[model samples]
Target: MTTTSLPIVSTCGTTGCSYNHDSDCHAGAITVTQGCGTYVDVAGEAGIDTRAQVGACHRSECVHNTALECGADSVAIGPSGGVADCLTFATA
Candidate 1:
């Protein structure tokens, strides 16, 4: 039987997230780094365009895991190993 692929969605629910653009996380495929923190926090105002300082991908089991691109619909970002960021995340 042929199976259809379901749409994947992610969202950055952090208090002050900089990876969100119009409620969308445009940050490329993120990977985990050797350091403790895997993300760079941006300071300014909410709903404003901010930059996501590349860090690392805590989710090692992500389906879009690759050396070049993140095939997953979105990525969860937050503390190391925590669900948070995404590329195709939509706001509810």
Candidate 2:
């Protein structure tokens, strides 16, 4: 038998995001598109202490995306205009 862990959010630089605290994401799960689709602009907390994992990825061009899911060991997010972008994304 084998087990694998979901790709976790290793770091986040979107300070304006509600789920971001000290460059860490507490959103539980995040969606990756050209930017983070799960990003929230409000100033608050997700009320969760756990780090985020890639729930779904919409960038089929990203090498780390396997069947709309992140297959990397981990992922990083950063601010992009008013949203968050997947910094770990690479062209397939």
Candidate 3:
């Protein structure tokens, strides 16, 4: 099923990230890491827009992931390993 919207990008939710703003990501693309880059802190995540699309993802085992890229229309990112991470990651 389609996840992201047309233009609005599902930004990251990671705090202290260079691309994170009000719990939203503002990067052209993002790379999801294993372990430390998964899970969405809904409580911590803010300003999340469902109309965002996933530019690129690295969760190989994610159901919405394909070849290190996100198949989901959009994604949510957050803090992981001191970096912005994908919050929409789900096991395949």
Candidate 4:
């Protein structure tokens, strides 16, 4: 099988996360975007483009967080308790 390197999974620091396997995201796909729990369409702040490119994550408590980007090969989102949380969040 051929693999494309477009979307890379960010390392998850949430041990409570399901997709987190030894600080690595095995979901193979993840969504990266700003704004959590609620909408923040405030003025002054530039609007961010929300796309599922497994690009970067907004989670700060994650270990694999570098410049807000995921380092995993890929990650899986959804089936969350509420918002689309990183299934690979492990605590430091």
Candidate 5:
């Protein structure tokens, strides 16, 4: 599979963010928590493998979170998950 680098947004300093430290998203999987009442995937671009490339959520309203930590009950990959700005993210 061709590996393509997707443009990642910085993780916002909102509570419950995954990319809080060094923006090191190595999970290769992403899912939006339920409490935020929304779902967003940071890995779904062409040539980008969401299951093989780790990513971080920049959305502050994500339900799967609690102070920059992934609090989601489950995580999955799909095409609906788009990119967003992480208000708390910074370049490593």
Candidate 6:
């Protein structure tokens, strides 16, 4: 099923992600692949109020993914394989 609203990014532990501040994701939206496709390793911060939402998800095998979008109530991102990943991803 399709989700009416974007999924909230509850937390992020990607240390070098530009969208991450104080362990929270501030990107307007994030793309989930094997890793976080939208992760930027720059030296800046997204607006403090700009909480991230899942814009797209490529893990079709993930239970939280529906129609290329995230259907989870919330998702967490973290460091994995030297990149950001969707820690909430689970097999169907």
Top candidate by lDDT: 6
- The residue ranges of model 3 lying beyond 4 angstroms of the native Cα positions read 1-11, 35-53, 79-83
Ranking by TM-score: 2, 6, 3, 4, 1, 5
Across residues 1-92, which tens digit of lDDT does each residue of candidate 3 receive? 34333223455555554445655564444445663233334544333433334544556788987666666656655554555555566784
Per-residue C-alpha lDDT of model 2 across residues 41-81, encoded as one tens digit per residue = 77567738889888889999888877787888999999755
CA lDDT, every model vs. true structure: 0.38, 0.84, 0.52, 0.46, 0.32, 0.84
The list of candidate 4 runs beyond 4 A from truth reads: 1-52
The better-scoring model by lDDT among 1 and 3 is: 3
Per-model TM-score on C-alpha atoms: 0.35, 0.88, 0.56, 0.42, 0.28, 0.87
lDDT of 6 by residue, 31-84 (tens): 999988888887777545767888899999999887888889989999867588
What's the lDDT for candidate 1? 0.38
Tens-place lDDT per residue, model 4, 18-89, is 444554554444545431222222333222332224644677667766777665555544334544455555
Give per-residue lDDT, candidate 4, residue 35. 19
Report the number of clashing residue pairs per model. 11, 0, 12, 12, 17, 0
Give the local distance difference test score of model 3.
Answer: 0.52
Compared with the true structure, what per-residue lDDT tens digits does model 5 show for residues 1-92?
Answer: 11244223223222233332333333344433322222233344222322222233444455543454443323333222233222222232
> What order do candidates take by lDDT, descending?
6, 2, 3, 4, 1, 5
Model 1 Cα lDDT, one tens digit per residue, 1-92: 11122122244444344545554444442343322132345774333233332333343454544442334433444433343434332222
RMSD of 2: 2.4
Look at candidate 1 and tell me the lDDT of residue 32.
38
